[model samples]
Target chain A: MNRYPEIADRLMGLDEAVSRFVKDGCQLAIGGFTITRNPMAVAYEIVRQRVKDIHLVCHSNGQALDVLVGAGCVRRLEIAYGGNGRYAPTCVRFKKAVQRSEIEFEDYSNYQMSLRFLAGALSIPFIPTKSGLGSDLMNYEGFPPDIRREKKVASKKYAKMQNPFSEQRDEVVLLPALTPDVTILHAQFVGDDGTVRMKGLTFADIEQAKAADAVIVTCEDIVPRSFIRTDPDQNSLPPFFVDAIVKVPYGAHPTACYGFYDYDPKHLNLYRKMAEDDALFREYLDEWVYGVSSWEDYLTKVGMEMILKIKANPVIGYAPGLDRK
Target chain B: MIQYSDNEMMALAAGRFIKDGDIVFAGTGVSILAATAAKRIFAPKAVIFFETGGIDPSLDEIPMAVADLRAMAGTSLNSGLIEAFSIVGHRKLHTVAFLGAAQIDRYGNLNTTCIGDYFKPRTRFSGSGGACDVATFASGVITFMQHEKRRFVEKLDYLTSVGWYKGGNSRKELGLRRGGALAVVTNLGVLRFHEETKEMYLAEYFPGVTIGKIVESTGFPIDTSMAVEADAPTPGELQILREEVDPQRLICQAVLAAPQK
Candidate 1:
């Protein structure tokens, strides 16, 4: 019944997938909105492998971006929303790095960045938008204007042109396409043929998959193509778009996966504290990163009880104790 | 008279501005509370749109962020950021917005990008997510922030989102299509913009609030000739807000600690 038997058995280990696709000085786009379903397991592997000078890209970034910045694995950031949620104070490392001129920063709003992905996915040169016309984010040199002129070029990607259709004085801004060298995404399920099914809030996942040169998918379960074909409405990304598939359960741990778990606030709080200081950050790396061999070992370090405690209560979509009733 | 917290009063003031069938573009936090209050009290047919691409969601609880899963699932339309801005936001007319600002000027210009300077900011916030787009496209925009001397500045340290730039005809010069920011709701009072000048002036003061406190708190001088005392929250509005809208009391918890004390 299926025609894609050649693409079967695409499942592989996390570290092996990271090593095979990611490299130094490569541009990497990560998919997730804030602290939900980010490819944190593969991100940790990138840190462990000492992949330096990598350019980071995401529309809505949170702990994962902060972790990579804290680990010194990033040299450039193409960002839109880089703030933490209400639970934490701020992303301290990202702020410090930007202030210290350690990282090249290019800023975009949520709409602007999404249009960039849409353009890339459509194979268009650029897309027209009315979002960033008057804001300072349109500068050709990028944010922190005097810091790194040569290294920051994303702001130069925009151009202003007259809207020919409008008789009135109107000008539309064009945002250039963004296609990264490699992209990483975490999902609830993926088929052996590399079809990705995200449970909730597919924020730029499909666009990034179609736009990137290579896409590495980390999923909780690798099911047969037949399972994915049953309820095809939830089938977000098709197999032709994905390059590799890695099966890693609890892949979005610390961050929540809808219908699977709730975010570990205590762990995020601990990370927020440790990420502020360099020595503590290194110690955190030792205890969490190099201290483990594989994803299974990482879960063991996190403890089974804690994992079970954060499991989703099917009725409310979060853990039971949070109901407060 | 019913006793109501300042956060509830602020929500009431914002909710009163919504019509029955208005389309509102809501941000996180206070905006959600205000819009929810509106839906329960008067504007039953009011449609709420989140920038995360959710249109008319069936919300059970306050979402943590605009991109929360609850914002997407079971919505009338579940699109992405592109459709939010391009197809629905920009193309449509008569859309309302609920905005937040770290600082605001007399012209209603907002600052959420940073403070001091763009290069070396004294304090930096997570830059505007969809605030700029909303400020640019929406027909009517309302800003909500804690009223304080530092926040009501004469000039913003950096203008992230434009309200009525330089007071008059500036938005038109920029080719933007919308009636700029119309009102700013604070814990102390309500401020409305002048029709021609576009300058914000004190329109009403909440219960137990004094005119002197508002005048001292504002960084710039304002017109108070048309000022009126605001009515206390009605029992029906308070009951719905407490029992159904914010039963968890997230907004109440924030405003209970200190309210013009």
Candidate 2:
């Protein structure tokens, strides 16, 4: 019906998705950060799905977000807080993009992103709060010089500030309403009618659903209406809020789906390795997410036996979670 | 036999600077490894607040990326992933690890912000999150970065956190508290500073990495080893570093080869 195929078709076709999202100019806002992060799948799906002009906003400074930015899906980013682990560094792609002046970057604290979502959910123009007041992140798109080099330092301004009415010292950072063209969310269960349910803190998902004009929900398994009706309170997003719903198991293969499945370190390492080599990244996605006909087909090529083998081998020093593998 | 690399060795040096009963912030690389190694070696009682990963008593290899936080929480020693988040994001703990950058100055400042110019220059890197807060109030901050010339610039394009811009004692002159790079361990050597001027002097050396190489690469001047008596990693420290500190030796896995048969 549209220039691209249906939403479900777009999600499974790796290179197609990447071209659409990473290169095309589609303004998209993703959900979740590190722990409960659902965006990686959507990110990979974008690379797999090929939706374009992607814009990401979240509370984490991790690699999934970096992947989208790195793939060049991001023309501009609106984020509150973001970082990879400490030793690795932050937004390597963003830094390089900034160096090259390749993209426009609008940074806010994660709280600001959260507030934006809350404002959207609450139906407001912008939340009138100051969260990043005195911190140095206010003026510059990035940050000030390393305080280490200074013989003495000047005072700083933050990106967000806190409320005087409350006793908190942390910033209240104001977030303007973000109305993305579409929103993509990953969840545990989805019905044919587009209902989402989760076991943990859905964070600002409901707000995200309310803010966007179009929404797509991806899931590992699709439940019937009876299932969702049984535990309606547990449902994170209602059916009407979601425009499209696709069920793809192991959708969160590289990124964990939270309570549903433990993280796959092997897949993560593969992504890390892929990021180190652009050709490999494209090639791998081409062979995997896009090339395969379905989730079952992709898993078969990756080898379920290999996954089981990986499951048997505890990730060495990193402990084994609840054994979802 | 335990296998380690120069980077892991750097982690040990960074860990050594941590004292007992200190609060720490953590990220990945040597920051994560060094913090754990420090706990394994000394200051076992040192209080560490993981950045939302409940990593203080982490039992497994720390996932390097934030998404790994899910893996970490799912697997680490105690409570669920949510509990881990509480420890890092909200819980008030001490002495955590942080990643370092290319251009660290004489005063113990680090630059992970940008490359070209502040007004509008080259590249823009990931900026501060809790890094500013950790670097601001921690007992002391330890910086870890691979030592290289391309990285060590005269002035940082932008600063990620507040390091000792002046010297340790002089930080107050610029109006800062307990926030200076106390130790910076690189592949080439170990360095400490004048708590105020941030003036640096070589404290130790790595066998393969040379002083000349470091001198050529560093952005600032280093107190000559010949000019001063340098400290050495004791056998005990070395033994712990090779064995218990990183028994699995995850650091150089990024690029390691099978032992030459």
Candidate 3:
């Protein structure tokens, strides 16, 4: 009888997971909306490992996307809007890149982009929606002629066709499926069998996970499968959907994870300031990403006091002393 | 009588457009303040759909971003972007929306896409996130923007969100559902679309602000014949704005109110 030795681990370190799944020029979708539950650890690892020419797909991007853009890791972006909310300055490097035409981008509305993921998840060729009617996005007019022509080669991203079911509307827009090579998500919990249980808004997590060739989940903790099964309704992704599970306690630090911690707005403000200067942004990567060997070391630099300060309070759901600032 | 900054007045004026029981697609900046004030004061049961997919969140503090976890606090349904927008689109969710614009035309079409030629943009802004969807799908839309000649334009450099869509039944002809711009709330006055032509006109003027000033600030000719003095912020509205809606002056700050300052 052939016997397979007991597997040393289904769980791997952050670096090994990133090295294995993320490749240069891959179409990657990182889950979360703006500042909430972003896969920051994985994003930072991708940057530090010097992955290049990534085609990013996101709905509303914020700091994590900006950091990669600042690091010159991204070559193309398919997004709706990218900004650090009002309290922080605009993502300076991203703006500069757009102005310089260093990165080619295609803009879609949030719902339109979400629909693309839904189409990918449902294994459909395309899905129709009225979101982009009369907007320049439907024609890809904002892009330079060459880029626009290149973007149109896919054809299905925005194909205008008559609505067969509707007599009132003559035409509708269809978005192509966006099946990324890999999708990374940061969640609140993952069961032993890799059933993902996400708290707060599950913004595109399940869809992106199911729409990817490989799904990597970085979670706060690995809990018992029985614990997840007890509340089966809350499980967002089943075991078969996840390719890898990484336990990173403060994975979404700086960004907030619902029910776990509050965002460090001050840190984000500091990052916004750093992003304004190209030299300072590189220095930030050095001190924050390369200067630290691992996630534990990064946490050490972030300090337990600051972490505890932003820790979520039970009743209010954000850090107790946060808004007072 | 309490004094109010133009920013606070804008939020208060925008809030006036929200009816009780209307589900508002609330985003960041002044819209959050306006929607929160409306929910707290006029429309207590109104649902707010944050772009984060939180519906009717019970926030302890005013959310800075639509996706902020503060939006998830006490939310009835913490869904995703697809579910929320599809709900609005398919369910006829009886929604209202708040939007901001870099440039707007007489037809109320908004431009947040670019400042110059589309390919060679002079100044590029963050493109429409959910504004286009909400504007197309909502039952009524109210926009908040500073009153500046550059912002109130004769023609947008590029159209990002369609309001009345070249006036008349064109919006409906374009397959838009039964919602379009109802008001444009600026510091100086309130502008509304013409029922027939869909052209914007000065619907109401605020205290100490003249129709001439509004006309001077706008790039296109505006009708002022039927304009009236807008209802001032009530004592209750002002108190809620100052004390509860924005105690930190986050939305009531001078930079937004006094742009030249």
DockQ of each: 0.38, 0.14, 0.54
Between the candidate structures 2 and 3, which one is better when assessed by TM-score?
3
Say what the RMSD of model 1 is.
3.6
All candidates: TM-score: 0.91, 0.68, 0.94
* Candidate topping DockQ: 3
Worst 10 residues of 2 chain B by lDDT: B252-261
* Error of model 3, residue A220, in angstroms: 1.0
lDDT of 1 by residue, A175-279 (tens): 888888888999999876677898766778778878889999998887887799888988889887887788788888777777777777677777778877889
| Tens digits of per-residue lDDT for model 2, B203-253 | 777655667777887766667654332344566766765565445555433
Clashing pairs in 3: none
For model 3, what is the alpha-carbon lDDT of residue B186? Answer: 88
Looking at candidate 3 chain B, the ten consecutive residues that score lowest on lDDT are B252-261
Q: List the residue pairs that clash in candidate 1.
A: none
TM-score of chain A of 3: 0.92
DockQ of 3: 0.54
True contacts kept of each: 0.35, 0.19, 0.65
